[model samples]
Target: MRTSGRRIVFLVGLQGVAWLLPAGTIIQQEEREPGTSKVKAQATISIDAGKLRMEQEKPGEGKSVMIFDQSKQVVWMIEPAKNSYMELTAAQVQQMGGQMQQAMKQMEAELANMPPEQRKMVEQMMKQRMPAPQAEKEVTVREKGQGEKVGPYTCIHYEVLTSGKLTREVWTAPMDQTHLGGAEFKTFQALGEFFGKLSGQAPKGTWELSGMNQMQGFPVRVLEYEGPRATSEWMLVKAEQRSLDASLFTLPAGLKKSSMEGMSRE
Candidate 1:
């Protein structure tokens, strides 16, 4: 689904704030193993008013390309822009996963120590600060199709019912070429059940689905369902699996250092 420009700005701001926190403070974390890559894949997303098309390719080490189209015009492109030495090994990815698990446990312990009223207040604050839900509840899976000859893998298709009752479908294949027919079916069923509970309404908390994609290249996930308010269709665009150049993950260069100094003064 194509997101409106306003929604893009809002999400970018939200992500910026999220990145300000230490990695250990993240609510959810997934480790991407090094050297994992997907050859190619396509995703067609539909929502209330529009649809988005995505094509991705990982051609070499530390390089990948993502092309997004909405309403038949190329809207966005993601390419390798810079380089850094912060690459991770497979073992390190596993360790990071463990660290994330431990961090979540610690956070739960701390939250448990809070008084009842304080915890309630905290929950309320979190809900109030939450972003708009990306996927509308009207979304439905109409028909699913699969293929077996795609590199020792199979593709799972999901039919999405838009708010206007229009049906659109998307096909996903594993980046690692692993057959995920059973798992994909289960995931779709579970997602449908969860959406059914909302009664075509948005909720008041973030909903996310993260894991590997069809090609087994890199970890991919969805962070569109944010709360009761529906997000723009554009937010549903799928990202590809590939090594993200370290520079893209870091703060941009050439900004005046005085901004930090001024914040300290305040």
Candidate 2:
């Protein structure tokens, strides 16, 4: 769950390179429930080129890792507990979404032609299969001025509201923590853009990280809420830029890889 700080000195040499941080740049986030303030999960993220790897650690449960490679246009979910890994390409994910839409349309047409009694049975069946309509979503990110310090970084506050309810409250701090700047920081901005594209995108209403561009720094602390109660808080704990082996970005050896369906099997 921890990225070695010992390797960080090597990353300093990567300044002004095409890749902003070194390959092993590790960013850690820890989550804790609101009222109880109990730790729930810990996540470590490493990014290089078009590849992003997230390793999540839970107290009792086994570890899980997810890799999203923009160059390959694919996502992989890995469960070390089961020794299994699954892959989903961008095309495949979009195709699955398309199939669901087609099925819905076909069901609507059939219902339109059915008799009253038959329609009622079909409607009941549809209700069981179809998900309920989601509430109309509204996403807005508003700056809330200065925020309290988190660790060594001073933060700026911002609120992400959904349908007029507060969803995420963020404390952002400047990238100076990385000791990267000038041309290197500019390269990092470009890298962020590429990462955004690989991670699907923000829909019209979903505010998922929508206001990042407006902020001057990375979000160091994020508090998520369920209605008025705080669900959990995520904050950046440690960041280390270090040399990394390219092999880490690719699939680890001795693991079976398949589509999502295979995820449950292995």
CA lDDT, every model vs. true structure: 0.33, 0.66
lDDT of 2 by residue, 1-266 (tens): 13556446446555546465454466777887764557888887775555667788879876888776666776677888777788766676567656766877898898999999999998998666563222224667898888578788888899988778898888888767743334434433443443343232211111135556666677778888777887778868888776666776788877877666556431
Distance from true location, Cα of 36 in model 1, Å: 33
Error of 1 at 106 (Å): 1.4
Q: In the order shown, what is each candidate's alpha-carbon RMSD?
A: 21.3, 8.6
List clashing residue pairs in candidate 2. none
- The sequence of per-residue lDDT tens digits that candidate 1 reaches over residues 24-136 is 10111121222233222223321111111122222333332222122232222223333211222234334654665576468568778999999788667744754223332
In terms of lDDT, model 2 sits at 0.66
Q: For each candidate, what TM-score against the reference?
A: 0.28, 0.69
Query: Candidate 1: misplaced stretches above 4 Å?
Result: 1-81, 123-266
**lDDT accuracy of residue 48 in candidate 1:** 13
Global local distance difference test of model 1: 0.33
